[model samples]
Target: MRAAVVISPLASAVLAGCVVSQTQGGAEHLAAPDGAVYEGVDTRLLDGELVNFVVAMRGARGPDDVTAYAECAAAQYALIRGYGFARQVRTTVDEKNGAWTGDAVYTISPALPRGTRTIDAEVVVAACRENGIPTV
Candidate 1:
């Protein structure tokens, strides 16, 4: 009976590990080509010439986990930009295991260009002291 119990738990653990491995693998495949993952941003007109934007980050393990790391990076980016811009925004982050995620909503004035206005935004997540910003 004791052996059976041990074997049962071991089997369960192995199954769990397999599930996690599969999930992680799938996430890696879905990861952005540049290795920089990005979630869709929902944009709304808060006022004339003003817009409210919601950015979300998702990953494997769990959407919440992916969000957590993303939020931290986002906050740092916002702070580097300026408080004026950061204050006009709200952020949410979630994480699970090795996965990370983040979400934010904010308002911007003066409006951007008609098309997509890509700004230079990058964050350092490790201590390797390497830059991940892509040159446009």
Candidate 2:
């Protein structure tokens, strides 16, 4: 003989709540609690294919936010120059008084740049727009 078990409605509701909370909380969440303010992006052409991007913003969670801003600028710049890809050379980030700045250098090329940090101009620009980050 086997015994049957049953769950009450209240118990099932509590179990569903636990699942909901678990899905809502995790390390992948990086959005700012308050709204972020994007100051602007300054772009400079350093050489034939090398470019510099300076981005400023407020309410950044960390360096990653500023870095993304620079990347967005580079991606749009590459697309505007009729290039399909960009390779990140370097990025420097600083924060002061709740304001953040990122200085980044990238090389734009018609082909995929020779680097591990290469970005597809179209894809990155689309993602930036989806994330509410402005592009150059």
Candidate 3:
């Protein structure tokens, strides 16, 4: 009976390990593909009246297939603008180590004239679909 108990615990531990390993492996595999990750958002005011917005994102892709990364960056910017928070957007994308990092900036004005407010936006990043399905 003691041997049976020991075996059961050992089996459970092995199963747990397998599960963990698979989960981590899956994440790594997913991250390996050319894609992007939304880091965070920052907002500020320019000239005390013009609202400024900045979104931070990271993307990765190979040399030949940069279109995916570009699309990803555009999607990120559009997603934020869709929220109706900013008036206009100025975006910048940087690529490094087979990865692309992007920053999107915009502006928001308050109701009162001469009043500027900066809003830091946060967005979730997900993998693009094969059929061009919206991931946001």
TM-score per candidate: 0.29, 0.76, 0.31
lDDT of candidate 2 over 82-124, digit per residue (tens): 9988888888999989989999999999987564567778876
**lDDT, candidate 1, 1-136, per-residue tens:** 3221111111222334431212321111212224445554454545542434444443344443333233334333433444212222444555555334445443322222222211112221221012221110
Model number with the top TM-score? 2
Residue 94 lDDT, candidate 2, scale 0-100: 93
How does candidate 1 fare on TM-score?
A: 0.29
Descending-TM-score candidate ranking: 2, 3, 1
Model 1 spans with C-alpha error above 4 angstroms: 1-34, 58-87, 96-101, 111-136
lDDT of each: 0.31, 0.71, 0.32
**Any idea what lDDT model 1 has?**
0.31
What lDDT score goes with residue 37 in model 3? Answer: 53
- Global lDDT for candidate 3? 0.32
Task: Kindly list the per-residue Cα lDDT of model 3 for residues 38-136, writing each as its tens digit.
Answer: 554454545543333443444444321222233233334434544322232444555666444444444433321121222212211234333121222
Ten contiguous residues with the weakest lDDT in model 1: 127-136
CA displacement after TM-score superposition, residue 30 of candidate 2 (Å): 6.9
Better of 1 and 3 by lDDT: 3
Query: How many clashes would you count in candidate 2?
Result: 0
